[model samples]
Target: MPEIAPLLGETLTSPTAFHAPLHAPHEEDQWWRSSVIYQVYPRSFRDSNGDGTGDLPGITGELARLAELSIDAVWLSPFYTSPQRDGGYDVADYCDVDPRFGTLDDFDALVGRADELGIRVIVDLVPNHCSSDHALFQSALAAPAGSPERAMFIFRDGRGEDGSIPPNNWQSHFGGPAWTRTAAADGAPGQWYLHLFDSSQPDFDWDNPAVRAEFERVLRFWLDRGVGGFRVDVAHALIKAEGLPDWGGRADGGSTEGFPGWEAPMFGQDEVHAIYRRWRAILAEYDGERILCAEASIDPLPRLTDWVRADEMHQAFNFAYLHHPWNAHALRDVISSSLTAFDAVAAPTTWVLSNHDVVRHTSRFGLTDGTPRGGDGIGHGDPQPDLHTGLARARAASLAMFALPGGIYLYQGEELGLPDHTSMPDDARQDPTFARTGGERIGRDGCRVPLPWRADQPSSGFGGADSTAAPWLPQPEGWAGFARDVQAADPDSTLSLYRTALQLRRDLRLGAGSLSWSRPFEQSDVVAFLNGEVLVVLNMGEFAAPLPPGTVIAASTPGAVEDGLLVPDACVWILSTAG
Candidate 1:
């Protein structure tokens, strides 16, 4: 550990100069409070030119599908220019679309088509870091030590005699050292720069005025381009502890796996609130209730809501709720606590079951005694996923999440009940975690394989019908069973379940409502709650339970209630008069 020293720039100070209006005086509607947004990972969504990788045009072509799914908005993952080191998280340019995905014109066209279908667009904003190939980083590498260009990044002199070692013991989110040694123009080992993620992505020094102003400008550029909002990546990480002191061993990127680093110097510092306060003011200048959804993985649970206070971001991902296991007690406790905390701040809570960075919930639920862990080591060894059992629990979980108050996010292919391709070959793996862990971990590739569109067509119809190019991440042969075409025709499929639930959620006015548990019951195996007019019940136990008092309106599994009994591992939506 290194001794604490004064921070490089100014001592943390108050942001009283920043004005965040509590009320949007001219707001049209706060749609995000109840919006069901769907997340689309650009590289795996669809291939328009048959280049074997998904692009913006492909997404534009699929807007009708999203309209059919009844999503209020689409949160497109990074389509920005990138080296693809971290699946576009390592951005080389914030303003332009990557040629691999499409041109800037193509992106504008995507927004146009989605708008025609009444779907808002929320583009991802990667503020904490940038790719090494980014012009700013390139200039930093070419500049001399202590130069203004270098000041934009966290460049520090190494501790050792020859300055060959890293400035600190901090580790990267992927693995290994967080600081990577940079070379001078003469080929000598020079200073080290901070990269909390992969070496290809360098962390920005928020202490620098240039960095702060740059991001604010980027936000306005997109807002002016007609985007509804931005999904902030690593929202809690822009601010670091005073001296960058060590907390524990390397962190698993913001996960709260009983680790001491959950509150470490690297993440969730109090100063971060000031940054979002300024951003809220920026959003206030816009017409729509433009939002900032924090992908913050803060712990102690309550602090997650802090990012969503009236003066700050509009929503923060409910990571703890998504990480809970299938146990009824645990799920109920998390839900109650989450709703209570967010209600106190008057901020909407966001629920998400699957994202591009984690194992698909279907495969995760399939694991026996599944404990929700991060994307490392999930697709490695045996005890192969029991797809049958996993799909059942996932369907039930979807209904339960939809019934909760506040907003919800649907990851691509989640509606199709796609399980993680646990058998992806080691050679095909691309997640930074896999390489950083030296094959000890399989990473998140299992969940990112291109989605299956048509069952009989080549490329699973992810591209054109006769295209011979394969998807960037190969789809498994078994994927045919879960293809969108096949599931679209099956009324009993998970796709149908999601569509029905989403429609009912809107029709029943479920989102933004209050949630309360049902009256005391003897069967602890079943957890039941009422949100608006919908009564949601989930039976996690092995045996069937008596159905709650309600009219069965929808169910995850067909015939979930037979002979007035709710089957185990099932969930149902009912219209009940009882609270």
Candidate 2:
């Protein structure tokens, strides 16, 4: 057993400093070194087919936008076969595309097109579980005792009454029990199979060799299709609590939080990096210059370096920002901790503000809904207005995300400053969880709503022929106000800001983890940062902070840090000098 060190001084004590590495850090291929990865939720991107569902062809057509912006890569959500249980997150088959998304050929075409545009293509890989409709589950249901398929799914020995119940105490992410009896046994009668998410998405048993082999095959399938790399979904969740114990927590404990009697590993587990290393080996087979930005949260930096060896997942998402308070101290502490981990792990990092899963950034900084009253634990709160206040915070966040070290992932609509539209009628809920779980889960439908491609066009220029005529979700009121068309023309628009930041990242080695965050002084309202030599200030309050003496590099809102008393809820800037 490794000796635990009592971390003292500037760093926290830890059992072991993260040093895992699946692949060596690429100093030369800086394309993704500190690249800002912008995620595109296909359904919300342009709808090319007019089927009301975003497809591969549409992504291919829009590849130029990312290339022109010099975004290192585009992380597309699962276009694979699925029951759409969790917004195309549940995979029905690893090798095929769901018809609703288009054909495998279409995927190939999109990949080819993205490559042509110099934009790398990274598909989301959901390996933790598969759609209940997946053939492997069905085949396993038919397998006799000791059959390989039987070992694929977590089918455990049931105790007591109706064998339909599982052997552990875990809750499904969607709701209800985690285990359900498989009645369609080809050889065996009703037995139990565990599902951490929805009944339709059953967890895969990584303890089994066959299961591992099958997953390898699935990964190779995409690599063979000329994919740059993969965005591992719930990467650490690949391994479950070996001892199925009841985890105490009303909030979906069984899924990962519900470990009864044990260490109950959740997001990132120690044994999981080995699996990532295997992926590294596979990608190397094709000489692919790609990365595996793990969708890991909790135990991320514990073994950060280990995950991105010359071989494992290249980067893991630093969610410190997601979990931190909306204050300079909180942000500073999170970044400081992150830097320590990055230094310890020797592995690079992936940073994110908003993704398909979380609430939009505009809402997080008291911009949108202003603030959620109490932890009602309901939806991510109503539409966050005060755009005046929110927009400033957003600009600060953008500068911070871009200036910080590692790969930064921008949500699809973030570039345009789209806020979640909470004004939708109650009956219009599009998320299955909201419809099934009463909206507390805050399903991602609002952010996943269709993209507004055209400003003048009602369909946001996505489609006018059916799909464009009627989007999957209603557009936010402030959307057309910042549409791409309008922003494309306005040099000061958010889109312009996004492009400028990305360009600076590429041209200047700012993507490299060379950021030295200046100590954030307790000011009136704005938070500031010294990016290299330039001080980036963000205004969070309604009023502007006085402009501090120095040349201003950029300002999110009309605010400045004068004499140290910064403005309210806005970003401020000052250039750095060798002196």
Candidate 3:
């Protein structure tokens, strides 16, 4: 381990350092273009009522902590009414809060508190599907074939004799056939409905005008309640090809190879653009320049940029950059391609590493073999990660991400350098993917563990000091070391690193600046870029490298720079002292 050292002396020691006023602020209308938004998985954030599950009141209480981090907005995952068969993604009531999370009043309080802190709130909008228990879906089940209620969803006659087989070879994202056969009054096989994800989540028939009009009302309902925007869930899969054609590719959803040259009939259809244009116009009618962000995963890289046209979404998640290997050349290629692609559509690219869905980047970077193992759950039998090495690379990667000229999304607990609970017991897994795949694929439960707040408190202070049940997910025994209270006291802790980096990012307006590669290190393992007067260098090689010409400002890892040499798996920020 590198010897820890004080970073900024007295400035870091002061409690108010993170609360310092921003040196430059952009207009409110264009905030999404260069903002740092934090994503909160509500169930795992904090349990205020001591029910093991986090609620809106808990998130409301943490607005001050987010404000101190200089976050421009908070993007909350779904907390709407649901049976939770698919972790709340299967929404039964789009306009109401689930009792497991809190009442509608609690949501209003959270939005109100966030506004006072100058942080906007963005809620997840799962438009592509809803829970089978949803009122409309339930009514459709009872109605006869071809009824108007049944038209709201993708219900069709199966292809086999007695209508037994699925409509097509489409496979659910979880596993198994995408079409589920419904039962008639006498329990005979009836019409089949399409659900690209879990069977509990039936896809809406966007072709229906009623579905389109209903979503318009849903958008306005939240916009009127003061949410700054919506993160469109499965944005690309909302529109299927004409005639609901059969997929000629693999059953597991065709490979991403030959992406721009070939397109998937099930996803990223051209018709999807029209829907976003209409939604964008709806957002324009609201005050405060509301925005829309697509969670689309289109491939061939550049084709993903189509979702962010000027009249469409304000931004789209850059999955290409997130999934790139931890190689210098690979990272550079993705970064260059992302900036170029989004620039063509006049949209600012969004950068993200970890979220509730995938393995935390700390663990992902730690794998020596670099096998893609954690997209599903990482079980006890799986190869373990070297967390020590992972933390070093994760810190370095974060610095590189912040130096880019676009918006940033930070997953909860990443600032404390938390890794996925790779060894989580198999029986404790809750993701539907696990049950659907019958243990063949372990699920996303490892990354969804509750966060640690205080080192000494029960459940790592996630449930507060009050009496209650255990956390929804069991926290690792070593989590006490990564607690917020523990890291806040150590000047060299990852928490301090994030606090200092975010503060500098806001003060320098780095997000609004342009990026240019450092010519000398361009062909080497060093990723060195100049963002205006600031120079950011990330050394991904095994050997030490000489420092670029500048005055050192901040380093990602303590002791990253020694005798003017930067060690491997580290990053540093330097300011041009010579004009």
TM-score of 3: 0.94
- CA-only RMSD, every prediction: 10.5, 7.7, 5.8
Supply the global lDDT for candidate 3: 0.85
Ranking by TM-score: 3, 1, 2
lDDT of 1 by residue, 252-317 (tens): 445445555456888888888899999999999999778889998887788788899999998898
TM-score between model 2 and native = 0.86
**Tens digits of per-residue lDDT for model 2, 298-323:** 54344445566666777877766665
Residue 259 of model 3 has an lDDT of 34
**For candidate 3, lDDT tens digit of each residue in 128-234?**
99999999999999999999999999999988677787888888889888999999889887899999999999999998989999999999999999999999998
Cand. 2 Cα-lDDT: 0.66
- Runs in model 1 deviating more than 4 A are 1-29, 253-262, 369-372
Name the candidate that leads on lDDT: 3
Among the numbered candidates, top TM-score falls to 3
Q: Of the pair 1 and 2, which is ahead by TM-score? A: 1
Between prediction 2 and prediction 3, which has the larger TM-score? 3
